[model samples]
Target: MTEPKNLEVCGSVMDGIAEKGSALESPSKKQPTEYTVYPVRWVVLFIFVLYSASNSLQWIQYSIIQDAVVKYYGVSSIVVYWTSMVYMITYIPLIFPASWLLDKAGLRVTTIIGAFGTCAGSWLKVFSVPQDMFWLGFTGQTVVAIAQVFILNVPPRLAAVWFGADQVSSACSVGVFGNQLGVAVGFFLPPMLVRAQGTIEEIGADFQLMFYIVAAFTSVLFVLILLFFKAAPPTPPSAAADLGSNLDSNFLQSIKKLLTNRNYVLLLISYGLNVGVFYAISTLLNQLVLTYYPGANEDAGRIGLVIVVAGMTGSVVCGLILDKTHRFKETTLAVYAASVVGMIIFTFTLDCGIIAVVYLSSILLGFFMTGYLPVGFEFASEVTYPEPEGTTSGILNAVVQIFGIVLTLTYEWMLSNISDRWSNLTLCAILALGTVITACIRSDLRRQAAQNKG
Candidate 1:
């Protein structure tokens, strides 16, 4: 019966009068309008999926066809591995500037440039199709890796801009799923495209065809993005859209704010460890599988396919759960714990010579490992709200790259100098450490929810 709290707080008589007029307006005039949902946003997301897939396709291209690549190029296994490592290496130095571009220029301009880089890199690989052009392939990979710096950091930003609050995490899962799907396809397709065993000339010819096929696909996606992708919706789709104080902050100010956020910093460390380990394992998956089960060397692609499929499915499911419950901290910790168990089981079964056990363990490992990605990205955005999503995600990815480089190099050394079992056990230890860190995180979302209720 008394004045509503919000109306009582009005500071001026004029403001109170305006509030009363609005509150007492005719019922017909005051009727709430139905919020119109745009379908064009999905079209834009599909284009982004293609762009994300193209960026990742090039990353594992050589790794999937490792033996043939080493033979055709006459390089050592170490050199062959660097073709993939270059992607992580390039990201570390470039992510900050890339984040600045995303925040300053907006998503459309950033993604268009990223698409062009992807197309250019794909075509550049075609020139390296000759048996003598290994260096050229590496050069092309460098360019593509740079393109990845732009595209990979945009998913959280994309979700924040296009999706409603209830749907942000699910939307982000789809974007992350696209990259993982690309890696899955990369693993499955290359083995079939390039023969298991081949003469240098034959291998070169097969690789030439493969490059052309990928480049053509990337070119089509680039055209699509240029023509249709919009930076954001015509109207804001979520309350968070109005909360971006950091968007107008200069590059240094944005960086400083993110670094000072306790929740964001903790997530950066924990998330970096999880993803860095994934990158290292993904790059070295062929070597690990072949070492443990020599007979299954030809089946590496199948192993990768199973792992990725399980991970991609888990990502979507986890995303849905987060959206429904907003239990960011609990969800992340559970997956990290499950992943450690999965990896421990996988490590023990690796050389047991039971092929079925190995495959099951691989799928479990993939499901838990890959599923955590979207949750981590979304959690970081929540804690760092109003800070540009691009900056936060970019920093997380850059840290992951740094960890990936170190872990990859360390694993490579361990495989050469120690037993495969010991190397994997060390990784299990790292995963356990990540889980501990994840458990300690205090969810900023929980605090915000409490405030809203009050």
Candidate 2:
């Protein structure tokens, strides 16, 4: 058995991090080292994808059927809405602890926390649903949301550890794909399962059944992860990944270094803007649709499903392009620009009195908006190289959660007080700013540069 060793590194990438135009110095020359891409990496990635999806499904589960949840539970709309809001609320504070745990305990332990939380929460919801205990269900939702703080930070670190440089971005995209797919399920499945027009007893039974199914699936996954998930591969997959293992794992130190990096700071703001708006739209989609076209809660869920599906396609396409071109800045900017354009078109067309057009517009809005997620993750990893991916990625997730809470509340408030047109138009303006910020990012492909060294 041989130990994994980091070969010679390009010290220049670390030196030029905070300074623009000051990092062109070639990697200190060193002999190339052979790295292997293990077949088991795919198995690990598949398991991670499943894990991510399981947790993300809960995020929009209540939001997609907000009206029904309120009716069945005899609760206020806000209480029903809190089922989804809790994810952002809990993630904001817990991501730091989750990241520290990832740094110290590794992926297997993190997966356990996520899986167990999800399983326990699902069972708790099942227990609460029969009696119409809204508070208990909310507690269950809170527990699962805490699990997400751990789940969301896994992709970049997992990709860096298990994939070669050529495939890392695509691998990251696939990891995020499960989460988007799970959201897609949440959007559609509830509508099919729990009929809003049914009697209260019937709907409550439906809710109980839904929770039981989720609990069964999560319990099985918890067992699978316990049996199979490994912390790391036997050897490194690429030079950058090899060196990344040696990067500083100190939580505060990683945060300090990432904050000082100019490009990463810009990305943090831009990513927050992009994701925060997505959260707001997702949270209020049912209401937004109902405002214009009454009795269209199901349509809202389907439209959200369409958006997530399109975004899943966009993520893979963009990931392949990044792998081929190594053009993180261009891809991110293009996606951000498309998201702006999509939002503008969606804002005006949503009230066109045609559901078909609304669905079409949702595809466009979702394709770029959702697609931008993994791109932002990969880009952050690139710009903040040598910073432990777990720590750096944790900060990114935390900022987005903060923004998600603020933007979700703000947009929902505007919808209640003002008009839909103004609220959406406001989002368009914020997205445009994010696009410009994406354009201004100094293309410091530090991680990629490290891989291409002599």
Candidate 3:
């Protein structure tokens, strides 16, 4: 018996993915010689990317244009905050059941709900964009938030189902790319489209138009999903896919095992803190930027865009590194430390009132911070191998949402009651603690170890 290696070769990356025949088989008893990798996996992944991107676009759409939402709805900024934070709040409760559906019901079934739910929520918001429709808008937003629970944790599971061992981290990164790209677009587009200046009706009309655009986009993707999607490849992509899921006793049991994992628990804490701070900063980004330079609403949106765009590049780089090196702990720690440094620089430079320096700092901050997202996902799934990726990622994400809610509220409170400097400093301290926690996590690399076993 031996571990798997890609002895078979194909021409291009696409060809390799399309016909990774013998590479699908581990040189051990775990994988059968006859197993094959399918081309349709890319099609499935493509649709999933669009589905998740659309859902995530909604999460930040109202946030980037916070002041506009406040003025348009005749509500408080905190009220506008809920428009974004509701996704986090709603995600915590619903992720468990959604992950269960992913683990039990499989891919096609899970996405069916996510796609339609997103479409329905988008259309609902289109109707709710009037000043008198804030209530309807909130309900519709909550519906979109609920749909996220079905989509958020599917990335890692999707990778495990559709990709080869050599491709897991990279595949997961693409899955994550869809999400961050949507956020990037969300941050960039809203401020350009909607404005706080203008008559209430004019502003409301812009908001309505944006919602309709998202609804139409999601509707098209929904139909495409129905046209083309698959539960899994005809054959498992790797030995893990061939055998791992069969070992999942049940969702409850998977959750129990995940909780017992010391490394994964540390990852949960670190990942939550890292992502939570990003969420906090993202949700009230306008306020943070406005603190130093007032009337820079468009600049704030651009800053958010740059951050996510930088993070997208960082995630791809990180994923490729992981694929080649398989150095999860080293890669994660380096990126995490860089992110902490970036945050510190941004905290001080923010008040400097120099847009260029702030943009530079934001790039550094977003590059590592957002890039850290897929690192945490792949690492968690790696350590908790065979626990079911959906369940592992779901619990991790739930913690992220919990922390997002807490940190956003806390940051908002401190921004209001205390001073901006102190508020920013506090979050920097928490992120440093998270980095320390990451340092303490042992690199058992259990999943890789299992793969290496012969």
Candidate 4:
């Protein structure tokens, strides 16, 4: 064959080999079937939805129990912030290691370990936890973060493989929707639970009740993962290495390879800025409401509920467009644009009008913010040759978190030291960072396409 034809033939053969290998390594015999009627896939998705809910429920408690944790622990709001910040910081470094471990350990063990750790940490919160409880919570959050990586990162790739390109975005969207719904429920449920409790023991019991419920639900997911979820069919010992051939690029090698690729680096920068901008706002919604209404913690929580609800709604819309159009680049751009404008409006106007702005801005931000995650994952999966799905995800997610921490801390500090008059400048600076990175990424992708065509 000619060079172009030869390359095409080689590519075809590689595709065939990958597909067969994927089938053999898949744990589920039923996989390699099809998304349309795959019983196993649905079961997996359902179980993961519950698991996601359990994971997300903790965020609600973070907002709701902020006061209680502050009083009980004799700490400041920043300390409670560290309670979360620690988890976020720990998760970044662990991403690659966790991904590597997932490759070695398989999804089952990693997920189970995460679930159990989360359950233990959550249940410990029911009573008077020791000073060491911070460590316990930290450990649990680490495990939970690991679990979330698998839960968030793995299924869509599997779905893409099983369902073909046509359905990947939709499948990813649905799974993500499940996660956001969990967030919505978490935001809405806690205040009602707190209100229902009559006394100190009753309040303690209520938290315990929430803890056990989450644990039980996650345990069920653990069972499902053990019983049905498979990376691929069984491979012989000799072929096992080949099973991860696409992922064969080790963590360090993958980082080197990705960094060398201009598009990948641009993507990293863009995703990191996106995370920094969105998380800075999401983490501070409680404070924002209190800032405005004064003693409106409950309202802040409710607004959180509204924000998540709008985000969930926006996710559905964005997912449909992205999946149907396959316009990954444009979709991200649109979301970022909406976010920048929203931040500007909210920062400048700071009135009852700003409440509506906050509501709309938060919802759009959540929608666009989370909307990028699956797409970004899909892009990484497409660009990277093979099995390092977890590793690539780890790298991307870690960068986002690292930048996110800096942005979050700086924003919090700015709010503390400066006036609300400064919100616009801080937000605009972050948004400008995002827009520039995204623009560079878009330019690089265009260059790559041109080079390939030439």
When 1 and 3 are scored with lDDT, the better candidate is 3
Candidates arranged by TM-score, highest first: 3, 2, 1, 4
Misplaced by over 4 Å in model 3 are 1-35
Instruction: Name the regions of candidate 2 deviating beyond 4 angstroms.
Output: 1-32
Write candidate 1's Cα lDDT for 198-229 as tens digits: 77677778898899999999999998998999
What local lDDT score does residue 167 receive in model 2, on the 0 to 100 scale? 73
lDDT of 3 by residue, 9-82 (tens): 11001111111121333334454543455677788888998899899988888878888887888888888889
In model 2, pairs of residues that clash are none
TM-score of every candidate:
0.90, 0.93, 0.93, 0.79
TM-score of 1: 0.90
Off by over 4 Å in 4: 1-37, 127-152, 195-203, 233-251, 353-357, 442-454
Candidate 3 achieves a global lDDT of 0.82
Q: Give the TM-score of candidate 4.
A: 0.79
**Could you tell me how far off, in angstroms, the CA of residue 2 lies in candidate 1 after the best superposition?**
38
What tens-digit string does per-residue lDDT give for candidate 4 at 3-122?
Answer: 111111010001111222333433223222111223354555566556666766665455555665554445577766664565467677666667766556655566566666556655
- Backbone clashes per model, in order? 0, 0, 0, 10
